[model samples]
Target: MSLFAKRIVLGVSGGIAAYKAPDLVRRLRDASAEVRVVLTQGAQAFITPLTFQAVSHQPVHTDLLDPEAEAGMGHLELARWADQIVIAPASADLLAKLAHGHANDLLTTLCLATEAPITLCPAMNHIMWQAPATEANIHTLETRGVRLLGPIEGPLAEGESGPGRLMEPLDIVAALNGAAGAVPSIAALSDKRVLITAGPTREPIDPVRFLANRSSGRMGFAIAEAAARAGAQVTLVTGPSQLTAPRGVTRVDVETAEQMHREVLARAAQADLFIAAAAVADYRVAAPADQKVKKTETAQHLELVPNPDILRDVAALSDGPFTVGFAAETQAIVDNARRKLTDKGLDLIAANAVGEQQGFDVSDNTLQVLWSDGQATLGPAPKTQIASELIELIGARLDATG
Candidate 1:
């Protein structure tokens, strides 16, 4: 039942991962999908059109204007022929072009002409993948209902390892099988306003130095995306992180804990739900040196002061939003989370154990969610999947309370 008889237009973009496109075509056909391959000029640098043509058993389309095919508008013909369009090894350049609606090439032009759903499997250097511009482009694509499969974490072509690898050919086929039947859920948060805080806030130590934590903000960003998909008007107050704001979500970037606190409280009144997910610094320098502190032979002592309790403050508001808080613990996870839940007067709290191996700067997560009456445990799965499940739970609990 996986992509059987589906007409898939396979777009190959420029990247080292282009070498895997032929295998991807084979896998798609193995799942009984009819695949037509398209190649960009840059893609031709890594793999030839003939190679794809041989594997797909179909002519590989490359040019925007063809004397033989343009007489009948070949791009339009291919555009109208597809049931779905998939770009494997979607380069950062391709993404930016698509995001900005550039149709100078055959593939981009076909994408503009097609009415079928589009899916992208991004592959790039780890640093490039995490770039702010790339993040914004991805966010734009997601909002336009373009699905993304992966830029999963793994070894890159340059011998560095991070989240820029293309999903394996077999894995892509398996995922497409699942994606083929997937439908958007009901708009559970329709007309609702959601405020979420994410990432680790910094506390300035000197002009060039700062105290920060390992929070990458992936979990919070995923939750924001899930909430947006559920039709909520989401405002994300995020600390400094490489991840961008999700599509259809408004992003407010801050650096210090105080800035995050200010932004969250400013918008908390208008929100229907609030998720305090930021790993904010518990303390900051009482009076940090105005200039860079010079290294000396003697020890340096910094006077630290407690930071504002953001979750508790928001919860204490009169007729405020239904507040949810997150607790990342090293030991006594549940006990600490439960304490925070009650102490902060939160409607619900999600807690997880964090150490060198789990949580913090990672892509996957496991959560123990607790409300006053009941509790649930969510998977040690990809953060995106966890976010989806967590959102479903949030929507159900919100309904129950009302």
Candidate 2:
């Protein structure tokens, strides 16, 4: 779960992407969010209110003029009920309506009446999205403080494609989770420099061969995003990965374990917090061929040498930052994590089980956080939720120690 449970009202508008509503509701619930669905009349053309009701385990609101609810001003009631109003698949028509403050429908009426922040995930044809009126309407909504998620440029439902496709349900969830209840002007980690290492470091055996792990860097990148959200001056020292850097983060890209170590050591003194989340290869080929080695008739012997202990070196610094380490073990998680806490002189260690289908290349992860005095288990959920909880925990610990 996130640090706080959110009461989210998900409004689905008329678009081909309305088919994704069920999965969006499921994801919100999976993150421990309370979800209620609001469907527009045109949305019923694609998905039924009954289908949404089944997945949400609640009645879906459709009619703007329901006799029973209208008796108590239903739109106003729902507007007050939401902590945030997220309209996914927000069509061009709906955007225009909301921008002009039209209350012809339930969703637009709720947008007008709600004090909660409005987030729109615009989904429409590229031509409609690029029109002068639509662009002006979006700017109008933005000026009124409405947050726009994405119409990420990619393939579209229409044969001709440009921009204006709705983001994936998971990406929407991540953006919502990142923005929910976020204070507009709090200096939570302000001016505090944070350096985080993420992803899998490659150790080259030859020109065409290298050693690496399955680390996707989702958790580490989530941490960087969360830290930045709290107003930290964040520097993400990352290994080679396809992931983009989080907004407002400085990414220092590196490849080999030696490169990561050099960067971390160089940046440690200036950081207030140092998180070693990269799955650096522990060993590398001692001697390598200048070129790609060809298959030999005889059995080949390869020498291996240990890589530098990046975390241990950082912890041993005279003026080191609050050092954190990750222990990915197959068994005896707590014991191994506790041992590493002392062995590496880490201020904190987050332990997880690796191998099989868990923890390495997945979007969701769990963590057992171990410190000298106590421990806390943080998962069985998405990495985004876990990351928020972890940041909150770190903030609390820093306060306690201070």
Candidate 3:
């Protein structure tokens, strides 16, 4: 139910995502939950205990051996104190330690000693996440009744992208609270057929290379999941992504923008809703080499041609499904979103500013949602949480219109 008075022992392990742990503490406190933090030795390199202390308004713990703490029985006391133990940025190393019964550190020791429910929000590189060792450890933890939130797909701290980004602070809080009965599922899209697109469409340059964007398809997949959970029969026409299709949703995999266009239009007529979340290439090489092109000393230019405007095309359909569009803008986010909302004849549009630090490849994003006569700002939170809110709004609007 409410996080009110709930005691949450947040374990921050060594990982780039550990920086987000302080914000998580604030979110917990905002929800009226009492939070105590435990940082692994590796975690301290990324963030200091003082940061957690300031946000949590409590002392930070990092050692299994503390002479000042309950005469060196501190780990057991913390174990007894918690109603829940949440490990955000649960590094691959920590997961293994927990799985194999390692208790060398205070966090691991507390986990072994505690009877409280444990939830882990795993954060690491996508490759590591897909590793057999990690998979086996996850399976073990799940069988032992441990809960996992996400190492959701998106850009990572390293200059690469995939699933491994930590769940955002508010998102983790929402999930924790939701599981505790703070929120209930709504069958808002019950019996509705929903069509969605996700990820980045790749336009061929040659057999060996292509043009693509930074979209990881996380937002689209999340919407597919949330919509499915809300009782919609969803078909996700996704571009290249490592994410598996959400449970209970149908999946259609495609690559280039042309392919995505074909797939969505072919199924659009049967849908009750269409969400165009893919970052489809606006243009493609006019002529692609049949074989890989040879590098030359002189610079070369590519002849580009415009790709089909899938959103505009869908929105133009007579009596089409309630159409929703996404606008990824580099500037003037609200104005651009509003213009697209009107110009494209979209029922609704969600826009966000995307750049090096925001939107495109990252796990967390903010949406400027616009319609004919109304607007709302959602997030600056996790894409999954934003998807849930947007789906709820879509359902309400759909009901109002009908």
Q: Find the candidate with the highest lDDT and give its number.
A: 3
List, residue by residue over 1-402, the lDDT tens digit for candidate 2.
Answer: 241479889999988999987899998888788889999999999999999999899889998899998899988999999998989999999999998999998998888899998888899888998899998998898778777766755677877676788877887786677557433422446668999999998888789988788998877988887777666889999998766566468999999889999999999998989988888889988986789989889997878899999999999999889998999999999999999999999999999999998889887889999999999999776676677677777777776676
lDDT of each: 0.88, 0.85, 0.89
TM-score of each: 0.72, 0.77, 0.66
- Candidate 1 stretches with Cα past 4 Å from truth are 1-10, 17-44, 48-85, 91-116, 121-144, 148-186
| Tens digit per residue, CA lDDT, model 3, 252-329 | 999999999999999998899999999999999999999999999999899999999999999999978999999999
Enumerate residue pairs that collide in model 2: none
Compared with the true structure, the alpha-carbon lDDT of candidate 3 equals: 0.89
| Candidate 3 pairs with clashing backbones | 1-180
Query: Which 10-residue window in model 1 sums to the lowest lDDT?
Result: 178-187
lDDT of 1 by residue, 2-33 (tens): 59999999999999999999999998998899
Q: What is the TM-score of candidate 1?
A: 0.72
Model 2 spans > 4 angstroms off: 1-7, 13-17, 26-34, 39-50, 53-77, 89-109, 118-188
